[model samples]
Target: MKSSKLSIKFRITFWYTLVFSLILALVFFYIYFLSKSYSVHDLQEELKDESADILENLYDKSSRNDILYNADWTKFYDDNVSISLYDKNSSFINGVLPEHFPDKVPFINNKVRQIKSDKNIWLVYDYCYEESPEDSIWVRSIASYGHWSRILYNMLWIFAVLFPITVFISAFVGYHILKKALQPIYTISDMAKEISFSVNLSKRIETSNTHDEFSYLADAFNSMIAKLEKSFEKEKQFTSDAAHELRTPISVIQSHCEYCLDELKLTDSVREEIEIIYKKTTYIGQLISQLLTISRTDKHSFKPQKEEVDLTLLIESVIEELQQKAAYKNISLLFEYIPQNESYIIQGDTMLLMRMIYNLIENAINYGINGGCVWINLIKNQENTDIIIKDNGIGIEKEHLDKIWNRFYRVDKSRSAGEGFGLGLSMVRFIVDIHGGSIAVKSKPGYGTTFTVSL
Candidate 1:
């Protein structure tokens, strides 16, 4: 298949890739946040511990009068940590006071304690200790809240670099993998497209590789194509044979008519010749009519004007109708309707179905031996309606049994050429197919032939 025709494959891959990327983004986001939170908390705790020791040393220095008292005390603080000191008078002593601190010293001022500045996300720890009986010092450390902001800042670069890179790589690999996987399907589709109505059916899908669903599909499609090719070939042959058969009688009639017209004397012999021409014309008309019926049957238009037909009555009527033909042929047509069940009310086109039976009977009478018996048994079982026509005539060969149902195919070429149009069994098969029934013929040369029809 062409890549354009496999748009469904791309659609599925797009959705899958989209979902996978979403999940990847979510996972990376979760890891970023977790790492930022943990790193920020640990860093803050470590800074606090180091800053507390520095404040202790500063207080000792102040007590010993080792430096100027009015110097900028905030200068002693590290840049990574903030510091604030309050005197015992509850006044600002060193570093900058929180801009929005409450006027009154809160309960947290008594000992080393942590507090949050609402105006900004700052962590503040306050420490207070008695320097002397009337003097005390207070220290507070402050820093920015750690995890969330750091993660946001870092992920900007990561996303900017990763998304396009991942998409390019994924698209390249997905295309090649999908193409390899669908190669067998492409082969089968190409073969199917090449199939034409007039094809000889020598080409079939290649199945030399592995076995899978595509192999099964190829086998099934090839089987159907084979059946259709065979059927079409049979149709072509039937038409050719039918035309050839009808031409002979038409030529005879034309010749006879021309001869009668050329006669100078309008005598008894001329009248006899005209009668022969008339009979030949009538026979040609009947052949044409039968051929039309067979054509309609092939087109599935042999719709019987249906009625609730009784099996026993229908068979008796058909036998009575064909009794004269059988008598003239010196053949015995016996019908035995064994009603295995009382409910034998079948729904079908009675007239067409009767014609189906009539064709079979006439065929037997024309082909069977003098004084030969044709046994027709109708059995209405629990499941189906069975009609069997068995004749003990010159039975067909094993090879011809399969071809006998095909149009214009004859077992005895010489005999079939003389009598009917060679479409009786073909019409029978066509009618049975339209009625959703099956027909099987069994024959043994020099023994007999039996046609079993089940509906």
Candidate 2:
């Protein structure tokens, strides 16, 4: 979609049709020239046959003196064909010729030549012989080349009409052939898109019975999916095992720290050190919980407990809950378009939806500048309910915008620490997708960032 280049199917069909058209044109021209050659050859042969007949009569009927008078050349006269005679000096002696015929074309003995005159091609045949020791005559025939080439003319007309038709038919049939041949690629692409959407890796593409390139491609795709499924299974097991195993240690550390602070009369420095350990341990527990949630979703075990919850009240409550956190930076929170009578209700797991909203607002508050403001707007329509969270924070850079939704991806690499593990936006994306909704973000450095969630 991003590139204007043509699809493989269409490109293949286009090139196939173009090559076929070239070959077809060559064949048409060959047939045209062959037919024209045959028509002209037939006319030349007729002229030779007629000249032979006249000579035979002249030799058999009279003496050399009266031979020209006895033989009737007028028998060959027609509108488009003519028989004539000339002397040894090439002077016109007798016979008929069409009007505007090019008589200037001198006779060449025993040859057929073409002459162009009066905007027409004239086929002229000259036959020279001796009647006596001192007398010679030339028998010649002239025929209208255009008038006698009807077969070749008709063939050209037929080609002119059939050329485009043949090209069109070839293109149509070639497109279907290419489509059928490349169906396996299409099948693989469609399956890949489905896997991407549903996050299911157990499916495989079907290979063909024959051992061709397409079949090889299908086998490769199936193998890749099988590997992904195996790797995904390992990752899922590891996260679950790690989360469960770390929970006991985290609890043990927290309990020991609490006992040390409460039971022992510890110094201020010692107590603060223990408290820091407890806080870091708690943060680790939260991280493990997030990893477990993502793992369960991947395993198809994290099903939402759907219930009707009012979105407006839920958002307002989340804002109130995070008010103390935002006050740290003196950032103000504003809510807009609070409906008076209309209730914006949706079916989802209330806790998960609240977590989704909480994470986004918390991220805004964490990233916001001192004295900055965050705006939350509720937009209702016939099809979808939109929640817009906009903040005048230090906006993300252009290069980092796309990567912000990736898990554990932090944009500010120079900084040692930040409030989030960079998983909040990733979790938000997953939540919206699972609920059959969508999310989008817009940000520009030093200006603001906006998150739109449509359900």
Candidate 3:
């Protein structure tokens, strides 16, 4: 029942008002009690002094019969003072005023008496003087109390009239100020909501005047978007390049098949044509397999069984496997292993690393001049391992050096006739990326190109 009746703001305000009102009521009650006690004390003291004067006057006259008992003595007393004078015999001289008074007047303790006729409640205390044994005085005064109901009646009006006005002004100003403070966040949220895969992510979040945490968040988000946009562009380029490369092999096979199907004679030239068709078909199949490997590598589907591999042993085996090919081209396959350590043990997938090395050497062999040098070096830095493949080949231009690692990007279109798919460096880059390594190339028009893989 309590939960259903109140809201959060109302409950908070209600509790606050309750606490405030309680404190205010307590303070007022304390003051009221204090003032009431002080008034009673003063009234009793005044009544005692008046009784002394009355007794002294009666003694000086030495006659009680001549004194008027009914004459008003109120002018001699304060407003709170009440007096009931008694003789030594305990008989009231004022003709038994207010019988509700205690029969035996209390000396120290106060007593309460309610008079129905006067509608008054008296706090009564008695005083006796030893010097005047003939007279005793009983003093009673009206005591006031704080009425909680009357106080609450006034407080209710104050709260009802003032609370809504105050809260309304506060919430009104708070809403506008909070909205302005969060304006940048709203703008960024709107922009992010509209962002799609097709959206140009070159746009960035707006920065505010303050250099605070929100600004830092905006900067970091922009950096993430930049990286995503670059990755998307790379993927699109890879798809286009793979399609073109696959089409070449498929078209060649189709053309040769069509030509052979139109032939009739079993001549030598016809046999040669048939052989060419077979070679094209075989090359097409090889291209298709290579294309699959590249696609799988790009998609991170080629999971390798990794082991600790000795770099020196791996390089030696690769050189041995490529020795005949190098010899056929008359290219010098120079191996430079300049490490004081016996073997460089690295954790990696051995087969993929071997394929990457082979591809790099094959690219050099295909492009390197006859009798030129292709240097393969393994160097170690402070915290990393480096593999440098430098070839004195038909070098790439400065403009093309940055793009050599992109798939199907060839420097010379005529030279594409060689069994190069232009995906070797791209595959090498992917392999390095998976290993948490980096690769770079440096080349000029006439000089040779150097590809450095740092792990």
Tens digits of per-residue lDDT for model 3, 1-455? 45566544445555555666566667656766675567556545654565555555445544343332653656334444445555455566542244344355434424343322233344444444333655444333322212332454566677667656765665555556655766677777777765542255666788776778778778788888889878966875686577667777677776767666667556888777777877777666656656666655644235667899888888889989989988888999999987675567788999889978888887877787779889999998888889889988777767677787787777773235357767778788878877878888877655667888887
For model 1, the stretches where C-alpha displacement exceeds 4 angstroms are: 1-275, 300-307, 339-343, 413-418
- lDDT (Cα, 0-100) at 100 in candidate 3: 41
Write down the worst ten-residue block by lDDT for model 1.
62-71
Better of 2 and 3 by TM-score: 2
Predict model 2's lDDT versus the native: 0.83
2 against 3, candidate with superior lDDT? 2
Clashing residue pairs in all predictions, respectively, total 2, 0, 0
RMSD of each: 15.9, 3.0, 18.7
Off by over 4 Å in 3: 1-271, 300-303, 413-417
lDDT of 1 at 34: 83
Clashing pairs in 1: 1-186, 304-349
lDDT of the candidates, in the order given: 0.69, 0.83, 0.66
In model 2, the runs with Cα more than 4 Å from the true position are: 1-4, 61-67, 70-81, 86-105, 207-212, 413-417
lDDT assessment of candidate 1? 0.69
Better of 1 and 3 by lDDT: 1
